[model samples]
Target chain A: GQQVMQIPQYQHVQEGEDFTTYCNSSTTLSNIQWYKQRPGGHPVFLIQLVKSGEVKKQKRLTFQFGEAKKNSSLHITATQTTDVGTYFCAGRFYNFGNEKLTFGTGTRLTIIP
Target chain B: DVKVTQSSRYLVKRTGEKVFLECVQDMDHENMFWYRQDPGLGLRLIYFSYDVKMKEKGDIPEGYSVSREKKERFSLILESASTNQTSMYLCASSFPRTGNQNQPQHFGDGTRLSIL
Candidate 1:
């Protein structure tokens, strides 16, 4: 059984502050995907990391995949009110076809204006 | 943009009642999934369909069944609902086995089911 765990289940920060969330998996993963769910909205795909020790960025957000491919992190710089949401990391194993993703518990981010 | 649509945004059902949750994707994706989200428990996959008329049980599929008669539509069924089944149900779709690049899942708004 594979389990993905996230730390800091909830986070609150000022508008100009920074925030980060960590994700760890019990087993090695082939790839990991990040998603964001705004208040009263569905989970939206953000980015995916495949290669080990890979890092990707989109504007104010940065995502990193651990060298072992069993962990990942998401960092936000100068967080804004628009950044308030729940961030989730989902991992896929080596197997193909019909293999479902294991999702992290998620870190709920709240920004104070 | 990919669009995944769930029939209901909220639903209420009584114990022992049968429930049906409908999900439709406009992208004609080969993979469709049903999941339930609970606080502290994360998102648990209940079932997924990789092709029409084919379904596979996921991590937590005890009281759930799925149907995939059409490529664009997938349905989840609860034979007899219970209070413990109350949670936010989400539907997702993705392309399957395309290449090394993993396709991200597109999710619907989700349906909050309440059993009384």
Candidate 2:
């Protein structure tokens, strides 16, 4: 079974600060994706990284994949109130002739006004 | 735009009762997935279907079965609902990728199911 674990299960930061969450997988992944779920909302697709050591950015958010493809991270610059949500990292792996995707426990981000 | 519509927003059922959750996607995706979300458990995959009438068991498929008679529709069935089955169920659809690529999933609003 594939497992993905995230660090800092809950994070609270002051407005105008930075936030980062790390994700580690038990196995090497073919690709990794990031999703955001707001309060009382479903998870929405954010971004995906495929190549090892790949880094992608969307506006103020930066996503990075580790060189070994077994870990990833999401960094948010100057967090705002709108950034309050649970951020999840999902890793897709190629198992024994099958494709398996595992979702991390996620880091719940809260911003203080 | 892709739309994954779940049949319900909230549902309440008694223990030992059968439960059916319906989901439909308009994107004609090849992959449809059912996941359960808990406070700290994140999204646990219950079942996934890649094509019409083709289904596969996911990580947490026990106590759950899925039907995919059509490519655009996927249904999750609970043989006997229990208190532990109370969670937010999500439906997502995505295009099946070739080789080592992966497609981003589009999720529905999710149905918050409660078993009493």
Candidate 3:
């Protein structure tokens, strides 16, 4: 079975500060996807990383995929109150010709306005 | 835009009662999934269907079952609901493009179920 673990189960930062969350996997993943869930809301798809050592940016957020394909990170620059939410990383594993996903425990972020 | 709709936004059922959560997707997707979201557990897959009449048990499928009679509909059934089963359930669908390694999943608002 594949497992994804995320660090800093909770984080709090002042507005305009920076924040980052890390996701590590016990096994190699074919691809990884990031999701955000606001309080009392459903999870929304954010981004997906597939290539090794790939980096993508969306506005003030940056995502990086490890060269080994076993780790990923999401960094938010100049965080705002609207950025408060739980971030999750899901890894897709191909096992025995079956592709399934394993989600990390998640990192809940809070921004102080 | 992909639209995944869950039958209910909230539900309350007594212990030992049978529960059914329905999900429908307007887009024709080959893969549909059911996941339960808890406080710290994130989202754990309960079941997934790749096609009609085809389903695979996910990480936590005990006490839960799924039905896929049509490509656009998927259902999750709880034979006997328990207090421990109370959680937010989400339904998602994805269409994998040919030769593409990543497929974005569209999720519904989710059904918040509580067992009394």
Candidate 4:
């Protein structure tokens, strides 16, 4: 079974600071998706990356896929209070025939006011 | 906007009782999934269905079961609830788009179940 693990189980940053969370998979991934879950809310789709070493930007946030396709990272610039939540990375294993998404333990971010 | 609706936001059941958690997706997705979220374990998939009447066990499906009788509806059942089963249950749905194995799953608000 493939596993996806995330670094920094929790992070607290002052407002206007930066934040980054890394995700690594035990096996190669065909693609990876990022999701955000706010307090008392459902998980929301953020973005997905497929190409190796690819980088995508969403406003102040940047997402990167590792060259080996087994890792990914999400970085947020000038973090605000609204950016507080848990970020999760989910990936589909390259060789796994099943269409199940394996999610990381997640990185919970807190922005100080 | 995709709407994944869970039947309840909170539930309580006694031990040995049978519990049913219902999920409905309005996006006409082909795949549905059930996951349990815990403090340090994160989201662990319990079951998923790609088509009606077809089900597959996920990483942690030992004490759980699923039903997908209709495309828009999926259900998770705990045949005999236990104290360990007290956790947050989330339901999600996705469609297979071009090039992507499956679209990103849209999640429901989740049901926080407490088994006593």
**Model 2 lDDT, residue B90, Cα:** 98
Question: Which stretches of model 4 miss by more than 4 angstroms?
Answer: none
For every prediction, compared with the true complex, DockQ reads: 0.69, 0.74, 0.65, 0.67
How do all models score by TM-score?
0.97, 0.97, 0.96, 0.97
Shift of residue B95 alpha carbon in model 3, Å: 0.6
lDDT of each residue in A28-108, candidate 1, tens digit only? 888889999999998999999989999999999999999999999999999999999999998887763435788999999
State the TM-score, rounded to 2 decimals, of chain A in model 1: 0.95
RMSD of each: 1.2, 1.1, 1.3, 1.0
Candidate 3 C-alpha lDDT tens digits along B25-106 = 9999988999999887889999998889999989999999999999999999999999999999999998753453657788
Candidate 4 structure quality by residue, lDDT tens digits, A24-84? 9867898999999998887899998989999999999999999999999999999999999
lDDT of each: 0.92, 0.92, 0.91, 0.92
Candidate 2: how many backbone clashes? Answer: 0
- Candidates sorted by DockQ, descending order? 2, 1, 4, 3
Q: Model 3, residue B22: what's the lDDT?
A: 99
Comparing only chain B with the true structure, the TM-scores of all models are 0.97, 0.98, 0.96, 0.96
What 10-residue stretch in candidate 3 chain A is worst by lDDT? Answer: A92-101
